[model samples]
Target: MTLLQSLIECLGPSNVLTDADAQPYLTDWRRYSTGCAVAVVRPASTDEVAAVVKLCAKYRAPIVPQGGNTGQVAGATPDRSGTAVVVNMQRMNRIRDIDVDNETMTVEAGCILAAVQQAAREAGKLFPLSLGAEGSCFIGGNLATNAGGTQVLRYGNARELALGLEVVTPQGEVWHGLRGLRKDNTGYDLRDLFIGSEGTLGIITAATLKLFPLPQTQHTAFIALPDFESATLVLNRVKKAFGAALTGFEVMSEQCLSLVVKTFPEQRMPINCQRPAPEWFALLELSDSEGGEHRRDGFELVLSDAMEASEIIDAAVAASESQGAAFWHLRESITLALAAEGKCIKHDISLPTSRLADFVRDVDAMLLARYTGLRMMVFGHLGDGNLHYNMLAPATLSKARFEQLEAQAQALVHDQVVARGGSISAEQGIGQRRVEDLRRYKDPVELALMVRIKQALDPLGIMNPGKLLA
Candidate 1:
């Protein structure tokens, strides 16, 4: 039987999609990368995934493991060759086990991140791996990318939260390493090897994720600041005052919030009445074991000190849960607003919190000077030093013209990032989009080690070809 027939036989015709049926799996979330695939197969179990991998290996066909297709870097998208099989894992959406006593959850790779969070909540625990795409992104993809989200400040990235993983090797062998033990000193940390490898080494079939105690109360606040420097000062203040209770510190420039307000009239900035809006706004979240009154008193005390020090100009604490959600909606809506504006140049960068203000001041000046009329919509999780430094094409430029300028803009931003000792791709993995940038910016020795690992794991180069290494 041909490869397509074999896939269909293994997964059934309904699960094995082809032609028009497979189109939805071809494109990345941002629609920045689209490719062709021979077929898209939805495997319902780890055994089914291993079988599909074996079939692909027998045919010398490449295998692209995909989750919910909500990746920012197009890491899950196949190549233009149309010779690869897209292994879609949505059908494997199952919570294999939840050990509440051990504070761990073993879930299939296709489990939606939001579902995982909800399951943990139902169990009276917390899974703090959250992102804007959590509603659609999968746990497998989150692990593959070592996703860092808002709460990464306190709990840590996906890699830190995962105690174990069940991965299917490129050779079609299942390595059942889902041990929920917090301390395991094995010969080689194979779990860490595959966590952020972007599927070049192996397919992550499932994971055993770490969990935390649910907070008694969560307080969200919207604070206005004069500049990024003041934002950092406020961040330091809260870090000291709240200690581990401070869960999130996200900062957005006035331009970003303005775009949100303009694009969605229903959403308004918390401190919009000022004659001139604050240059920066911060979304602060505190998850406390204490009660509402205690959390509120502590939150107000810090803000009051910040105001005394002139670190923050205006602040609005959410009076209720709905109001808190509305504040987050404003922050999350910036991306949607940018998408509506037009073509954009997006950089997922991270730097030392000390240099963030200087990096912004210098890069903003450089870009505006070279490319007149460029609009900057900057925002990110300040606590973790990750910024979504995005820019929109000038309204005067045509789509084609704007596309041509993308490379130059990226060079300017990435060059500055490297000079400041920061990373080009922060939370987002180096998918097809930044493969070249990875080559240019990554240390030569480190790059060589990565290549060697990939070669040892996938010698045939049939697993997610032309990505990460290339």
Candidate 2:
């Protein structure tokens, strides 16, 4: 039998899928690209993964690594040649170890992010990285994208939480750097190279993720603001008052919240008032130490002072855990709720926190003026300056026509972002979707350097071709 047939048979019928079996994972996130692949190989262990990679290298067959398949960008999907083999990592879902003493958890790449968070919580610890896709997204994909979430204000991004990694390079060699130690002054930080490489440099098979002590107390509050500017003021006030204790600070426009209530009737808004008067709202969370008597009082005091200073119009703190979860559900449901409306041109960009208000105001004015009746749903981790600025077409525009206008709208918005010293793609890496557009914003010198590195690591250019770098 040929190497391809041998691989399929050796990996087991359940693990190897072709044609109709692999169709679900081949298309783009929104069913955009309907590519073809020879087979989708799911390996349950690192040894099996290495063997498959070696076989692919011998056969000179291109390989596409996929996890969860929940990414917005087309990074995980393969090309149309129908010759490449896709290595799906979902079968390797396992939490190998949770070392509380070392403050780290060793997990296989296929483990779901929500599972990791639960394992940490069960061990009397916390894995603070969280996003809407946490339930379905894999930790490997999270590390590959170096994902940033709501708690980036308190904790950091995925890159920050990862202490070490075990990657399978393009050459079929396993680089084991899964050390849980915090202090390691080695020559070069090799692990950093693959963390956000988006599977172009290497396939992340497993990772040793850093964990944090569980917060003894958490205080959540939903507040109403006059506008984005006042929201900024309230953020500054809380930061000055609580400092590192401020775990989450998110902002949402009234239009965005209204869409959530309309899309998901089961979900309720936090505020009990009959009418939604505020143009903007903020969700604030504070995590404090054990027996922290001062946390709740301090949070209340800060809000009172902000109200007295007119930074905030009104606010409500969660009196129970269920109430807090309800408030967070409103924030987490923003993206899904919006998706239910229609086609959306989403931009996850970041700027300096101090300039966030100005950025939003300027972008809003520019888009509204160009596209009449356009709906801009703006909200995100305001404390971290990363805004999920999504533009929805008017109900009148068909999906096809709306998508046709996407490129033009993206250019207009991205140019303004570049001029303001912001990133074109913030938390989301430059996958197939934004590779070409990145060239417009990146410096030629830096772009050349990245190209050189990509060439050095992936000389054959078979690993995740046409991704990240053009």
Candidate 3:
């Protein structure tokens, strides 16, 4: 059979799509990259996926494994060449097992992050890898990128939460390594290799994820802080007081909040704006196994102490569940609001808590000094040191002029990030977006080791080429 015929035969005609039908898988969420795929294959089971991949291997055709396609970076997007086959994972959605006693869940790769969270909740547990794209982004994509989100303060990254993974190797063999054990000192950790490899090494078929007890009382609050320094101070105070119960701590500039409220008027500002809007806003959440009254009391006490110390200028606590959701709705709207603005240059960076406030200040000052009249929007998970620093064109500049400064702005911001002993790409993996950045900044020895590993596993170089490593 012909390659196309072979794929169709292996996955059924309905599962194999081409031409205009395959257009959905061709582009990325941000429209940053668009590529042609000879066919977009949706396999229902691990066996079907392995078969399709084996067929591709026989034909020497490349495989680009895609999940949700919600990543900002074009990690999952294919190249302009149409010779590759796109393996869409949505059809593999399934929560195979939820072990309540062991506190783990084995799930198919295509399951949406939000669906996984809901499944955990239904089982009286919590899957806490909450991100903006949770509603659509797949767990496989999360594993591929090693996604980090708001709850990293308490729960940790996707790498930490995933106990084991089932991956389809480059040669189409299924490596079933989904072990839920907390301690297994085997040989080299192959699971960690694929966790953040951006699908360059292999395709993750499913994962065994760790779960935690659902919080009995989840209190949410939005606090207005004098500046990033004060925001950090408030975070330290809350962390010391609540310890593990402090589930989330987020920070946003006043300008960032303003843009969101302007774009989505329905998303009312969560923080009280009594003191000239303050310089920064911190959204705090405390999830305790204790009763609501205890959680609320503890949350209120921290706020009172912080406010008295002038760390928090003003604050507003969520009075109801709907109110808490509304607060998060505002936080999530920041990304949408940014998109509505003109062309923007974004950097997902991380820094030590001690240097984070200073890094933000220095980068803002540096960018403004160099690119006069440039608009910036800064926000992120302040608890875990990730910041979404973005730059936009001043209203006076046209889109073309704004984009023209992306390179210069990116260079300045990223350099400052590194200077402060921080990472240029924090939560967002080095997909196609910043592959060159990874090459430029990553250590020579380390990069060589990564390339060696890639060569060792995918000698044919068929697994999602042109990502992570240059």
In order, what is each prediction's RMSD in angstroms? Answer: 1.0, 1.4, 1.3
- After superposing candidate 3 on the true structure, give the runs of residues whose Cα lies further than 4 Å from its correct spot: 395-400
lDDT of 3 by residue, 174-209 (tens): 999999999999898889989988899889999999
* Candidate 1 lDDT tens digits, 1-470: 89999998898999999999999999998888889988999998999999999999999999999998887789999989999999999989999899999999999999999999999999999999989888999999999888998999999999999999999999999999999999999689989999988888999999999989998998999999988999999999999998999999999999999999899998888886466767899999999876759778888999999999999998999998999999999998888899898878899999999999999999999999999888888999999999999998877888678877888999989999999999998898988889999999999999999999888989888988878886
| Tens-digit lDDT string for candidate 2 (36-85) | 77788999988888888878877777778888888877888888888788
**Model 1 segments beyond 4 Å from truth?**
none
Candidate 2: residue 265 lDDT (0-100):
88
In model 2, the Cα lDDT at residue 120 comes to 97
Say which candidate scores most in TM-score. 1
By lDDT, the better pick of 1 and 3 is 1
Total clashing residue pairs per candidate? 0, 0, 0
Q: Rank the candidates by TM-score, best first.
A: 1, 3, 2
